[model samples]
Target: MNGTEPEWLLWAREIQATAQSGLAFTRDPYDRERYEALTALAARMMARCGGADETALLDAFRAEAGYATPKVDVRGAVFDAENRILMVRELVDGGRWTLPGGWADVNQTASECAVREVREETGFVVRASKLALVHDRARQNHRPAGPHSIYKLFFLCELLGGEAAGSLETAEARFFGRHELPADLSTGRTLPHQLERLFAHRADPSLPTEFD
Candidate 1:
């Protein structure tokens, strides 16, 4: 979710997946061409809805066909002087202490994505200083369990500026260490071990950044 890929990529994938599957079983070349047109429509939808670079749109589509998966949304791991991680009480899952972040938008850089997600969820302005880590939400061997396929992106960000304010997406915005995690955690959004790993990055800079 920390990259432009999610903005249009998900929509396009869903569309093209269905269209390509439809085209493959059909014997008529005319219908195949029509399915091809559907694929193009899907790509254009990604370009318009995602606002990504036009020239890269088809390339993005072509790149996806061979052993691909859905784009994982991005999340932010923001910490403060108290060694506590910032948490949001999300509205979608009945309010929990997950990190501040959402799906990546088309126009922003990955760092910009980290900043946007934090600000939107916590009402805190942060400057992303590091490309801390990337995580795969699907087939999460590193994580204990899984449901839907997803990828998770975590960034190490500094609190550059802002006050803690809540919005429609989040209710209460606060900072907590490992001991203070909320009981009603939105696990669909984040897992406890992922938070722990983010803290591990903060505690030891020498740890290799990871993606899985």
Candidate 2:
């Protein structure tokens, strides 16, 4: 575990995972009630720890009704001939820069999700060439924000076509060289070392995929 992660976040995530799994498999009415209470407790913990509203947290937890699973986030690392990396300024993160990516939609393959996200966010067509990394968000040196576990997938992609353009989720689309990266990065989506690793992979396509 990253020592920087807050104790409250650790406790809240474990409790939420347990409660979600319990609710998924328990069929008895009494057991269901117990699991529901546990879910409430988890929500309360997150509210107290994160300074979020208890009622809203509870509602969010209650809405998640299936077997517990880590949410998958897909990212694409598209390098141009100059080896600069494609990036987008996220509207939701105060216009901080990040690789083009988002939550993996249902019914889409991971590679397909990466391709779609890159095109949608940066208006640049790409073909996912290889799976570069599979990262556990908690295990990485990323800023903490949510209660659920997250699995981040980074793919090496070849840029195909399309002009740089911004979408509703992105404020601007551009490429940055290794030394020219923006300091205000959306750490929840992309980190400095991760981008460095992608650059390394771009230099040598034979490197094996990285994992948490």
Candidate 3:
């Protein structure tokens, strides 16, 4: 759950995680029933407060079969020779700009996921050179809020050969200097301060990786 979220949302997330983990390991039928009820309660709480559909939330929660855990999202920070940072207009977010990234997929390391997300979203071939930041999404001021707790991995990437091209997920791709970053950022994915921190890391690679 996000630290910025209201207490009710945190309570709902805690309940859902507890219920999901319990369902994964419980052996007694009565315990299973109790967990199921708790799951329903969590879904109801989320739907009522988060403005999401109860059935959909329930289905999403029930689909998980193991101990609930924070999801991982990866972002690639690719800087041009002019010290401009690469950004993409996310079609899903109504063309708002963000660093090239998305949810980390299984079968790939976190750095690999960052590289893949950059390539997929911005057509930028890059190699993740350093893990710059490991931040809990809730700790970061992202909005309008999400159901699952997430860990965002920010990587400093070395640009390889590639041309800017839009993909299904992004409407356009370009680079911007530090002072020229777009105002309409996809806050759910990236924040201005995070970008500023990435710029600082670029300026001084010896800076230790930031984590929370």
Candidate 4:
């Protein structure tokens, strides 16, 4: 998932982020009006070029009430006894497989989010053992580019117990050898190279944490 982002999309995201921050801190009436207008402009830009619904995008943008910042997504790389990687089929992505994880929740640390996501999505009880990587989702070139910027955290988790099972968000959970990964991966959630890096880290825990 290393692809170039469309220039317009990048500019639109910048505009949206700036406007959101302005709305969060501004007190002057004129500034508020300008930021609100910028939000609408960004929504129109995305709708026209990115093929998104303007109303929905605007609503989502306005739903945030804080200084605009990249959202965090946590992914857990849980390996089995045979050194195979644990993955789950995301129901939200039409059943495409990805490492078991999701958005980092408020009031939870990165490791906590990884542990919870793995359990919720795959029914796998795990302990987050190491932080492997922190990547910018856009910089990684994840597919189906999203409006909001995101920081993705990859953690090496220890598989303690629990059997493979599906939750509301996932269809099933399974482990795959390095050479047998599924073709249809939910790239927005996990990427091939990212998984390879995780495997490398598992092989040698001395590797330093990676960041983008």
lDDT of 4 by residue, 1-212 (tens): 33478988888989999999999999999999999999999999999998889999999999987799999999999999999999999888788999988888889998999999999988889999999999999998899899989999999999999999999989999999999999999988889999999999999999999998
Error of 3 at 50 (Å): 1.8
What are the lDDT scores of the predictions, listed in order?
Answer: 0.72, 0.91, 0.93, 0.93
Clashes of 3: 0
Residue ranges of candidate 3 with Cα displaced over 4 Å: 1-3
Which candidate, 1 or 2, has the higher TM-score? 2
Give one digit per residue, the lDDT tens place, for model 2 in 1-212: 66657888888878887888898898899988998888899899888889989999898888897788899999999999999999999999788999999999999999999999999999999999999999988788688577778999999999999989999999989999999999999998899999999999999999999999
Which pairs clash inside model 1? 1-72, 1-73, 1-74, 72-151
Which lDDT tens digits does candidate 1 get at residues 1-212? 32323435555666677666666577899887877776777767766775655457655554544333456577778889888899888777565557888877778876788789899878888888666668766334432222124667788888878989998788879988778877667776777778888888888877887877
> Candidate 4: where is the Cα deviation over 4 Å?
1-3
Candidate 4, residue 203: the lDDT equals 96
Give me the displacement of residue 173 in model 1, in angstroms.
Answer: 0.7
Error of 1 at 49 (Å): 30
Report how far off residue 104 is in candidate 1 (Å): 0.5
Clashes of 4: 0
Residue pairs clashing, model 3:
none
Q: What is the lDDT, from 0 to 100, of the residue 96 in candidate 3?
A: 94
